[model samples]
Target: MPSDKFDVLVIGAGLAGLRCARVLAAAGRDVQVWEAADEVGGRIRTRAIDGFLCDRGFQVLNPAYPELKRAIDISDLRLQPFGAGVAVRRQSGSAVWVHPLREPARVPSMLAHGGVRPAGVLALLRWSLPALRPRALKSSQRQDRSLREGLDRQGVRGELRRVIDQFLAGVVLDDTGATSNAFALLLARVFLLGVPALPSDGMRSLPRQLAAPLGDRIVLQRSALHVESDADGWQVHSPDGVVHATHVVVATDPAAAAALTDVATPPAHGVVTDWWATDQMPPGPAMLWIDSRTDKPGPVINTAVISAAAPTYAPRGHHLIAATALLAPTATPPPEDATRQHAADILGADGRSWTLLTRDVIPEALPAQLPPLRVRQSVRLAAGLWCCGDHRDTASIQGALVSGRRTGEAILRSPARI
Candidate 1:
């Protein structure tokens, strides 16, 4: 082994890239990271404009991800907790209501809400009880029922169906019809037991924390053009210079990884988020608000007054509402006027006081997670070459970090990385 060669060269400064580098570095391996973007955190980026910290998209971390303890500490994130259960806006009543799983005392009130039928309550309970059990994991993956289909089969109708679809769309960034049944079980589990949270500073703080230890080992604005191997080992070509490494980790997006590794590129889902600032915060426990109507302008998937979740996200006396919707491939986002007007009505906030701050349209917000949701994805792509990312693993932060760690572990054991 040449002293000048890097033990591992990680491409992409996203969550997976940083995590892979950190693990390799900890094992006394000489590692370097390359990123095409000027800044780190990839899609987890946060921007500060006029004293407001706007996340690239709406994201939340659930406590169920055990990987959090492995990569970073919760205190560094200063997590802001979002209350359990969603606030449903009954399409029939033109009013907002709650399921009260958190407030069990309100169960009777929820039952008598006139819109919620008795059969709906039974169906919801039948689905929820299994999520708490271990069997839900297998059942969800094996069954062909998506969240919407499961609800319908259980005899859930009218307002309950609307409420369920509206809320689930926020998590999956798509309608119930498009979501897989495997995810439905996971959704039930999260709804029942998970505690949703966010970093007080911004979501990007997470990737920053992971990369902080590497210091100068990471190079920015240099994308991984191509990776090849010779008798001398691996050569990772970049715009500025080439990195000579014993092993190479391709931690880029789906399409890039597919191009680099000759692996199939899966379809990606697009999510467009528009932010608005207002003096009055929508009253609640940071619950998600969904649009039950498709005819509504922008056809918003979900809206949340994020300032309620993280106060540092906004300036004094102001709140931020993020109106989100699924975008078609290459389609433009709806105008700000329509998004704001629709959001104001959904959250019951005054439209006059709302001000548009910024709109971030992420073409690849998440990988399309359909049927056969595996608990883990393989990280090794070829001999001495590895790949890891949300596309190669789960579509959430947990999947990205976990896959990166898995790649690091495999690299550590390989004699090639020595």
Candidate 2:
């Protein structure tokens, strides 16, 4: 390969970059992907610590994502599934609220135990059923509202509302319910359609699967410092050397992408995830637990026995648990003591003996899915330059793949100036 020339140069090796390059390369385009990290997967990476597989943050792969289905074969992931619904932790005890379609048997028990209310169920249906329709799912077609206002208008209240709010806080990394209601409904539709799960290795498996075919096309430890357009095409400056290409795709994270392209920086949602190892596993099926105490919610938004969901995440006899807290912009992460105590309270376990594996504080975990959600944001910045990532779409694995594929398709359809 030439040291500083290519048909196309991609600036990041995340899902978006890899998927974009894959599409272009498959079409016989000379594409080379440059990733600053030593490995691929970007934010979705997994770390091996003392025989434990720890993902950078709490993440799962939803087979229901349309783009994901088209990009990679799901069977290869060896997915370990989580239960249909969450375990709501109250002062007295915890109750599991599952979807009737996924786990009908649990519905009866849930009702008999006063875990669910008919009004809340009806309200939830009213708010979420429209998401199933093609037209309503399109953000551009409907009247948009903040999640908090939308829930209020739809009558999703009381304990059910609390559970939904808390659970979604972890999902979107925002506890304030300021995210777009339409986006939340779309997210709910996917969860209803498919159970999110972890691969045998970790969330990193998703990116690794996408990167496998590209092989040598991906250049690791290579970061593009600046990008400039020339008469021929574009030039990407890096610490290593300058690379000139007929076209360039800035597929890095939102912050990095903003720096290298004309794209405006989007607001980011932060999250703090703590992984704990314990000899005694929490007794429960593989499901998320959210605090629903009538008094007051704790610092932790959600906690789960990760090992129960994917045993491969832990060593032979030990178990892995994860507790996640939403971080406000410029706010320090909740103290370790608070999160640990909240985890214990929510799980009804004594985590005093548990070992703290690691704490991951990602201030830019995901782009904020704010109100008036804009789906399919433009990828074509100029004739020969493009950008693609979750920020350009729905802020998810699905969005990243879709945006990348969109850029690749758009580029393929246009005539090359060079």
Q: Give the number of the best model, judged by TM-score.
A: 2
lDDT against the true structure, per candidate, is: 0.77, 0.88
Query: Which lDDT tens digits does candidate 1 get at residues 37-154?
Result: 9988878888887888888888887766768788998788888877565665445434335546566776677677636677877887776655666455655456555656666677
TM-score of each: 0.91, 0.97
Clashing pairs in 2: none
- Report residue 101 deviation for candidate 1 (angstroms): 5.0
- lDDT tens readout by residue for model 2, 1-418: 4768888888899999999999999998889999999999889989999999989988888888888889998899999988888888866877888867888977888877846788788998899877877455674535888999989999998888989998888889988889998899889888888898999989989999999999899989999999998888898899987888888999999999989987999999999999999999877667998888777546888999999988999999999999998888899889887898889888989989888889999999999988787887999999789999999999899999999899999889977654
lDDT of 2 at 191: 85
- Poorest 10 consecutive residues of model 1 by lDDT? 90-99
